[model samples]
Target: MIWPLDGASSDVVFNTWSHFSLSLNLEAASFTRYITPTKVEQKVRHLVIEWIRNEIVRHIPDAEVLVFGSTPVDMYLPSGDIDLVVQSKSLAVEGPPRSNITRIADILRSTDMALGEVRIFASAKIPILKFVSRHGKFSIDISVNVSNGVAAASIIRDFIRDIPGVKPLSLIVKCFLRSRDANEVYRGGLSSYLVVCMVIYFFQTHKGMRKSHTDPSSSLGNLLLEFLQLFGYDFNYLQSGISLRDGGKTFSRSERHWIYRPSQPRLCIEDPQNTQLDAGAGIHDIRRIQMLFIHAYDQLQAEIQRRDRSRSKALLLEGNSLLQIIMGVPLNVSATGPRWIAIDKANARKSSIGSILPCSIPQGDSIDY
Candidate 1:
């Protein structure tokens, strides 16, 4: 429970930011603990990877299956997709051959490893086979001969190691956007990688935060508040673009030759590895996203003020905590452990894949690579 039941209040006074900060810190820590994969879950992931590898190899002996993305970097949310890259001498850099993708899809469909339909997006810029695991515990995206995801994973790992507040902050932001249904790149929202880069940029560019020696863990509340403030109202998305290269800097969009599409108004996050690519290009509703951030910041501030006023009167106010007001409900971990709600289950789109036969790949369905 993120907050006490209605009509309940703490026995102690809550008149300062410290009290609210403490609550935020506790909630962040609790959420992190609940979302971090347990040893058993890790083992299951590994087993699934190995099973896929073995299945692929049985047909294409030279193919290599490699885990990438958040899974490799220990930054994944509970329901996050596992990204796998299949490398083979025969596969093209653009993507795997259609025949190969179809073959792999067939293999996956024949086995019980895949829970629902094995969807092969052969026409996608980077063709992929997407499916849910048989246990319904994981969603997996497999791309062939595409090394970019693997490379991006390595970069994220470096950021996690070198940056002070990358891990926890990223986790929190991921959950925040996910709860709002704005974390999927295919759905005009931000991807997990884009979310991470935004956090890294926040850490690198904020002078007060950069110069402070405060332990990130102890100051998560303040950091999160400031982060919302920065992105919500301060960032000039029309002129400024986020970049992680050269230790992080915000470049002028015009100077970078990145056009500002007023109609779409997407966040511009330059790909550190690929200078020409805009990591946030997929997002079509940047204004709405920023408005969401602003609302979260305002709601948190209001909660703090309300609590302070209530405490001044020696009244115990019962309601959602600061974090809960913004992030909605705290995830409920089932007693059975692995089965848990990664976000608010009521609003989340349930995976359609579930012990069903392979659906025909849509030739016209495609997404940016």
Candidate 2:
């Protein structure tokens, strides 16, 4: 059973949220390394996306370019990468798609936009073109015809439109995940997409705790606290898998027939569009992730207890107390080792970041999103 937030705990959560949101605009900005992508950063992404699309269409006339993910949805951090999908009838060919994508990457390299090395992952499950912009200070990922990502962006956009506070709550949690170095699922953590889905599931199912008349900001404080509690204490990954489309219900692990691997981290979040795809399949260190969630929860509870007693220490910890703990005091900027190093001589590889080719466009491509 879910733990209900009583009146007292509810007050504490609300007050803490107020302080947390305020601090995000104030004190948290001072110590936190990242910020919500500024207007200038967003404009730079638009220009880059246009440049890529035009170059692709020169070869494939029917090609279309779509920008999805957090950027289009208005929930991205300044450091967040722009996700793009290029689709055209020309890409459906006889051999691997990498050859064609590499050609496109070559074209992009010729342009001034390709400040850093442009990489082509031909062997990736979904072939991708990755590069960091010199002027924009943001990274980009271009995939071939990933219509699913476009669909996801549409659904999330609707969710934000209907649900108040969804944007702010998402920003806060994403910042928290970024701070903990747990947002990239490929690195044994969760993705921003999965986190967004989890927040939606919680909002849909917990009507008792949400008053229709109450502003979303007020509800968000308690919702944030409950979110950590849900993942940290209540959820059972071993026995069940989360199915948001099924009204946030749990289905037995046996029903899913997922092969158990002692070596792999297993926390299943059924993709609403595709049941076979475990949205959380990339999570390899779930225990460590849950520990952080629980710690955050306990820290808030302790602070609330202190506040109730009118303690001197509680007064000292006011203003940005919760925000500081959530975002952490000092950013972790360590370069103790090379960015990527191999253990053995045979596996050794050097940085491949600045390679480029000549790809330019006369005009910008039409954008769908």
Candidate 3:
């Protein structure tokens, strides 16, 4: 819920020079003022968004769009991507929810004549389409999750923003993990790639076992088998120079077992399908990253403890509080009593938003993957 703006508010700036300046400062005593330059970046993005919507409606008309990205709160860094979500009539939402990526790709084939390399996605739930416009490499990668989970995500983001002293801790932890994992390589256990592994490992270790994202006891066998399948690497490609290969179609017994390993450049490649599995690489890759992250994670804990001399003793915390806050809010809100109302913008032909980071990679860039 955002507060409304009144024209006659006493808190107003009357500097005529500001009208001619290339940037403006938003001030609030309780918060840091975010400065945005009067530049063409946002204008360009808004135009692209329009082209995207019209292109979608050219095929399918009845769809709702919810954008979660780095734009709204002005976190759109120069390196960020244009992220978006689409619910169009061309997509089938009944079964597994139609492939948003495929539809977007098809649209790109035709729409590229106008926008050039536009990215699109289809979703039965939460479909994300992210693209980079820099260096003329604009592309869209889409994925579908729980469509109904939008509100829950918002609540989670807002909860974190209300709290203080959370942001610095998370950055410290992530940096520590990245450095430690890089240094240890094989023998150590800490890393950026292994973060998910750490969390999943945490969940399982606390319970002494792994469970599917779904029911636990209902399919224990299936879950462990799937988990093992994830870590098993594609041994088909044996470190050759530019030799073409593909990921193993089957999971073998040896892959489930870890041998001595080494850590170097992270072997992890982009998995566009978002199956959220560790694919293509070997146990060596995970172990290497894990080794480093362990050291960083430990350092993060020490730093947090240092700060927590005035902080809490919670055994664990969802330290991703600040980033989560900006990520969660689809629109902004200001407190001004009951007049605040943040309108859910309909996905029109001229308006929509997407995620800020260009993390989603191309679908098929790996030779042996």
Best candidate per TM-score, number? 1
Deviation (Å) of 251 in candidate 1: 0.9
Ranking by lDDT: 1, 2, 3
**How many times do residue backbones clash in model 2?**
6
Select the stronger candidate by lDDT from 2 and 3. Answer: 2
* Per-residue lDDT of candidate 3, residues 1-369 (tens digit): 121132123122313212211101111100111112113345445444545555666666675544443333232332234455565544656344446555655664664423444444453234444554432233333444334333423432442253221122222223323323332224444332232222233233323332224333332222222332333231222221111113112232234431123323333322222323333244355444433334333433343344345334231121111111112222222322111111211111122233322223222222110
Each model's RMSD to truth, in Å? 7.9, 9.7, 18.0
Candidate 2 per-residue lDDT, tens place, 146-217, comes to 689888888888877876556766776776777788888777667888888877777766776345756656
Two-way lDDT contest, 1 vs 2, winner: 1
Clashes within 3 Å, all models in order: 2, 6, 23
Q: Please rank every candidate by TM-score, starting with the best.
A: 1, 2, 3
Worst 10 residues of 3 by lDDT: 21-30
Best by lDDT: 1
- Candidates in order, TM-scores: namely 0.82, 0.76, 0.34
Off by over 4 Å in 1: 1-18, 92-96, 260-264, 312-320, 330-369
Candidate 3 deviant stretches above 4 angstroms = 1-47, 69-78, 93-100, 113-131, 134-139, 144-153, 167-290, 294-369
Residue 361 CA displacement from its true place in model 2, Å: 10
